[model samples]
Target: MQSTSHSAVLGRRKEPHTIIIARGDAVRHFTIRPWVATLLVCCVAVIAAGYLLATTYLVLRDDLIGASVAWQARMQQAYEDRIATLRSQIDRITSRQLLDQQLMEQKVNELIERQTALTERQNVIAPIVERVNTAPTGEESERIEKKPQLGTVSPDQSGFKASQIAALWKTRTESLNKTPAEKADLAFSTITKSLRHVEDDQLKRLESLADDAYQTADKISQALASAGLVIDVDYDKANVGGPLIEIDKSQVFDTRVRELNAAFRMLDTVKDQARSLPVANPAPGRPVSSSFGVRRDPIIGTAALHSGMDFRTGTGTPIRATASGTVVSAGWSGGYGRMVEVEHGQGFTTRYAHMSEILVVPGEKIERGMIVGKTGSSGRSTGPHLHYEVRKNGTALDPLRFITAGRQIQSYL
Candidate 1:
């Protein structure tokens, strides 16, 4: 059993081993690690085990924690989605509300601005109207509320913002469950409402004015009623003429029906005002150098009473008619050489003197603003100027008395 075993030594030499590898478009030489396969296998097994565990969990969790966890995840997802949706909706609502508010604010601001403009207009018109013998009251008590109408809107309020309009629509909907598209219709409605509400107050004012006018008419009627003049109320005709044109018959009767009648009867006197003179001058722009009252005479250098104004104008300046009327006198007068007299309607008469040229003939029909003659120092004057005078029924009056400023008169007066 004891046998000598002969051992054969295996020759071993340390050497580097090179491996060749090839890929598309490239070649390389490398050395391979001995444990690479084992490591790869370990990684693959781990992955497989993890997948198996997940699969098992899904299958087994059909009853307890797994299913509950899945359900909770779904619920959380749903909650997130819902939150996103609500946030989007809230943004939309907020945007809409903001837009609406802006529009409404714009409307309010413009409306207030328009109110101011209207107030300014009232100021201008009131002064002009005041100078008239009888003017309608612009007070809330006297003004009739026009029907709500588009035209009545303050100019500044014409364009309303969409948001504001939307808010207004909502309010209108709540008020009557309806809305209107036509601005004019809305305006008309508003005006009508205002007019109706102010009826009593306006009526009282109208009554007061009517009473005053009546008193004026009565007084006029007593003195001038015999002048073949009539101041009767006639809807068919206006004393001034035109549709809706009203005549203050009450005042005509109370103040001076006869005077009015005489004024009207002096049809020839009125005809004179509109006459075109030989030179078409009407004394409309004639400037006043001397006043109508007592003044020192420029030539005499002494205190003297003056009955008229001296209108200083360039030679040949056009004179115009103050009112529509006929030519009463176109000839020269004592101390008022080369004079023309026009009798304007409305109990008004004007005289132009020292005219270098006369463009109109006597008994000529003329309208207000017609040129009658050219300015010149033909009468008693120191320089090239026209002696101008205004008279009401043979009574001299200050020419400035008729110049009235008002919104109504801004365009003409």
Candidate 2:
């Protein structure tokens, strides 16, 4: 049965089909085998499948390419954005660092200028302080135990020297994670504060010195008034001028200095006046035989006005000039025989009367304590004595007033 089925399949496959076609009187015949037909069908099917597959590929190619291009663009944009962000961050950091540096430099420069200004102020204040320290203060002299050495700012006191600031900066930078500019800024601020303190100290010193000078001048004035001598001091206007600059009231150092200088000038003027006044006793360590006023006349034995104080001393005792002056009259003058009159300036004069001998001639310049004559009872007197008279502009004044004032003012001088 298998052989029969196989023979049948083979016979069908070997069978040929014939087709005849006639056009007009001519005819044509064609024969086709089953195997050939099957082969042709296979070739047609293969060609159709290949065409369909090619068409499908052509339809999807554009979408695939578009997706791939989109993905690549996204990746490139992401990379670019990341790079831009990093660049911005780096720029910000760099800019911040530069700004910090500039600020630090500005602060440091300001500190340096302030320090220089303080140094200049010290220069002006040093001499003024020295003058105040050396000035006579009478009983208060003990209070001024020592004079400070000026013109140098102690770093330990102020804590603002350049080297110290640098050291501080280094120490802070090592301890902190801060940048160099930040550390520098901190150091500069510290220095500025210290310099401000120094400035304040200088101002205070100047103020104190100025007050002392003015007080000294006032004391001299008061002392002169006590002696019944009112002296006027005129201070010359200082030739000071400068370019206009805005200054606050707190910065009055220059004003203080000017005031101190004026005080010194006034003190000098008063001192000169005091020196010219007759204030010393002509015969020191001698007893006063007769007081200045109405007294009994030794020779006449009656009450009379005694124009001067009489000092009892042996004849030929040395008599000294009470003040520096010129010998205006050194010759005999009737009752004031062998008299020596000294003309001290400021309308003051001294007369040494009843002298046994005149040591200075008229028109001779003499200083205080100079031996101007010898004591004797040469003018309407009955004993060896010296008559000392203090006159102001030809008018007699109490000699005791000047003598007392001199004693009080001696310490100041």
Best candidate according to lDDT: 2
RMSD of each: 20.6, 9.7
How do the residues 244-356 of candidate 1 rate in per-residue lDDT, one tens digit apiece?
A: 75567334222333333343333323223222111122354455677678898888889887777777779998877756678999987877878889876556678888888
Query: Can you tell me which runs of candidate 2 are displaced by over 4 Å?
Result: 1-90, 133-190, 233-247, 281-289, 311-321, 331-338, 354-360, 366-386
TM-score of candidate 1 against the unseen true structure: 0.37
Cα lDDT tens digits for candidate 2, 96-133: 87887787677777877877777777777777666756
Q: What are the lDDT scores of the predictions, listed in order?
A: 0.57, 0.78
TM-score of each: 0.37, 0.62
Worst 10 residues of 1 by lDDT: 404-413
